[model samples]
Target: MNLKDTAARAAILGTLHKAIGDELKAAKRELGEGLRAAKQETGTQKISVSLDEGQDIGTASLVQPKAEAAVTDAEKFTAWVIENFKSEVERKFVTSVKPGFQKKLLDQITAAGVAEWADPETGVIHDVPGVEMQGRAAYTRMTVPDAGKQAIAQAWQSGALAHVVLPELTAGGAE
Candidate 1:
């Protein structure tokens, strides 16, 4: 295709991709409601559905109230970690304490679940300093067939989208 045609196609595809994304988001929201209803009807926190029974086209699973830990106040949390867990400090960060503590705390929090941890020296469980639980939602995660994976990879390797310089669109055709 010529440059003009390619650029036009890129613009159209961009718009279409965005529309498809919005539709997917709406569909997922509706599907989440349906998943919640299925959970309520079945009385199970974990639910799975197979779209094409024998063909294995797609699958979605839900784990209700999934909690992830997020660090809210890094400075206060780093100070708390340094004061409480001195030995767990990593020295490579910034020739100082805050960054190291933050990295260590993040690693520990990820190992433990949802802002929780065990004192390495004492063995008592406690919440990691400066962290809070976020995203405790009953969202369904999907897995679909990799039917276009090869084609997509080939397109990338072929640089099919490398030089798609789209012209700037102006409001009201202002030059």
Candidate 2:
């Protein structure tokens, strides 16, 4: 490249860099001012006042307590049910047998999208459904439907499940 081209490119880059730096500084100043305004509006600053009787009220400061996170009874019950029944549901799906009697015992692997059948007497593989001559299978993950949520909710309301209670905190002060 020529010297003129190089100089022009450098000048453009320098102008862009300076513009970006100035914008960043302006943004930081605006953010600091906004934060200060918000703090003052929220009563984070201390204030002192003098009464008519020449009595001075000491510096009064506002103290805001951070809210504590809590879990509800429904959430706890849902967690408990999932922990207890998740494995059982997965096992049932994995070992599920197709209805009706066939000459061969077929185990349907839904995730693999294939029905694996083997003869009991000869112990030979036979009749894979949806398998091509090239032996390629289309696999799909199985998802279990959440059909028990209503039942669980009903059971909880009927007192079949234990209820959970969370502690509540309140702030009190004299005016």
Candidate 3:
């Protein structure tokens, strides 16, 4: 309203603006110093931690040597099976007719040993020496039971099952 009032308000506004600017500058300087100090401290400190102490540092991972060994062993076992028991394995895995039919046929053959045979179509009854039935041998597939699988898995997960020791080497030192 008046010249004096206007001049006084302008001076106060200018001072307030300068104070805010100075405060901002000080805050920025403090932040920069804090960051620099943190960086320097981190650089100076070498984080040497031994995981063997069983410390709960953070989220841990289960590294089972037995699991890896089991996989290797499984590969070996598969190879052995393929090499040594190829025919047996094939017979075991082969899918064919139902067992009931084969069993019934075998039972009939056994019962009709050295008996007379009658041809259904010709109606000719003839004495036979023996009934010889020849076919591929049937074998039931051998599967690892669920309980066995669970046991193997448990063995794989158990620390006592297998242990692999890695050689320790010094870092940033002469070999």
Candidate 4:
């Protein structure tokens, strides 16, 4: 090849390299911005729970909870976990895979019976209320305050807790 042709080819290659480099840098910047926006719009965190029978009852979660009312010190920090679990479970079954997969596992438990002290989705023993003799006893603590625990129980039993738990925590804010 002649010197002039070799030089011309080198210049064209250099120009192409610079153009590609600029595109790569711009794409990286756009990706960074998109990540930031996503972080702001929908932050995410992991949650774990164990409520199986003949096993320990525990939950682990990382959330930024506001106001002691949102969760008292006596309660487990996994309140957000319960909330999210309910939401994910009740999202509805679809023909496609993915979201419905979790629903399939959770839907094994169905609401049933009179007292309703169990979780319909996971069949776990969720919050149940203390029946204050219903007609005679002034105060009883078999489950929770008079009818307080029962309300939670009924909700879990009938899937009502899904609506209540999610909005309360999401509005109060979470990770």
TM values, all candidates: 0.49, 0.24, 0.22, 0.25
Output the number of the lDDT-best candidate.
Answer: 1
Candidate 3 vs. true structure, TM-score = 0.22
What tens digits encode model 1's per-residue C-alpha lDDT throughout 1-175?
Answer: 9999999998977876665566567668877787788778996544333321233345666666545667787666666667676764555744234565566656677656668777677987776667876766677887655744454455457766343211112222112
Tens-place lDDT per residue, model 4, 1-175, is 8999999998877765665556556554654455445445775232222222222233222233321111122123233333535443322352222345333322322222222235456767644222111222111112234355455565578765555344534442332
lDDT of 3: 0.40
Greater TM-score among 2 and 3 belongs to 2
| Backbone clashes (count) for model 3 | 0
Ranking by TM-score: 1, 4, 2, 3
lDDT by residue for model 3 (1-175), tens: 8999999998877765665556556554654455445445773212221223332222212111211101123344334444533542334474332345334433544455523344455866544332343333222122345654565456557643343211111121112
Error of 3 at 29 (Å): 0.8
After superposition, candidate 1 runs with Cα above 4 Å error: 1-4, 44-55, 64-99, 102-135, 147-175
Q: lDDT of each structure?
A: 0.61, 0.39, 0.40, 0.39
Backbone atom clashes (below 3 Å) for every candidate: 0, 0, 0, 4
